[model samples]
Target: MAVLTVPITLVQAAKQGDKVAFMSLLEPSLEPGYRLACGMLHDSQAAEDAVQEAAFKAWRKLGQLREGHALRPWFLGIVANECRTVRRSRWWSVLKWPKSEHPVETSPDSGLSGIELRRALRRLDLNKRMVLVLHWYLDLPLDEISAITGISVHAVEGRLQRGMSELRRLMETRDEN
Candidate 1:
């Protein structure tokens, strides 16, 4: 499959210290990066912070991006790494308060299934969760997910399959309750 990418000229210009060119290259990626961060971190504020930090790291490391590489996946890889870093920080666990015993009231318009799905997703280990989010939520192909996660395409497919199975089991178990 043909890989879509920004013009090489723009990347080159960005690498040459052109801030506008950098922003132009970076603009289209922000939303996806934010979404990826949110999926991994499961906190909007943390996600936003992760994305911002990823953007800065991406800018600093733009020169390291190989020619012909798509900026989105590379940027997203950085975002994923940033999310992992956020998750690994000592403050992350300390900051996570226990969930209240009270069940949240859902508005009719708010999809309960979505909420349940997110809860199940949060229960998944980070490896499976990352692949599930990158493939299913982000609609990224296995190869792209592989690139983003720095895993083999086969490994990504395995994780995707296992993640789907686990998610299904989680959903089914929830339904039984």
Candidate 2:
């Protein structure tokens, strides 16, 4: 029998107290973590908090990580879990309330259509929204998304199809109005 060699052995060494190795291991994963957090929470502040918490948790549990090639998805799973935790907290309710006043924006890109599109996205159920962001925005395949979300591949496909239809309807309705 041949012994299998894996890159995560370096990560395991880092988990044993090699700071440089850990930093090297974690550097590439941060942006995706932030994006996932933002998609899950739909608020910049909440997303930042979730990413930070996820980083801390990932550090603490680094030793448990078994696969280096799969590290991105594993870290994203932690960030998504943190986002769920933040969303469930009481503070999230306060954050959820829409503010009465608006800040004037100079960016022409943020037109009425863009605003309506975002509002329509927010109208989606959380699972559908997650599927859309993960598949469409993040460009994850159905199987990988299913792994991260703990849904079956068929369920992921169904959610993506339903979400696309709903989003189309929403944009059309907004245009009509």
Model 1: per-residue Cα lDDT over 68-167, one tens digit each: 8899889999999998898899999989745444333345875989899889999999989999998877788889998889999999999999999999
**TM-score of candidate 1 versus the correct structure, residues matched by position:** 0.89
lDDT of each: 0.88, 0.75
Model 2 lowest lDDT segment of ten:
97-106
The weakest ten consecutive residues by lDDT in model 1 span 97-106
Candidate 1 lDDT score relative to the true structure: 0.88
Q: How well is each residue in 28-83 modelled by candidate 2, as lDDT tens digits? A: 77877777766666666667677888988988988777763466667777887787
The regions of model 1 sitting more than 4 angstroms off are 96-110
State the lDDT at 50 in candidate 2.
79
Count: clashes, candidate 1: 0
Cα displacement (Å) at residue 80, model 1 = 0.3
TM-score of each candidate structure, all chains considered together = 0.89, 0.81
- What C-alpha RMSD separates each model from the true structure? 4.2, 5.4
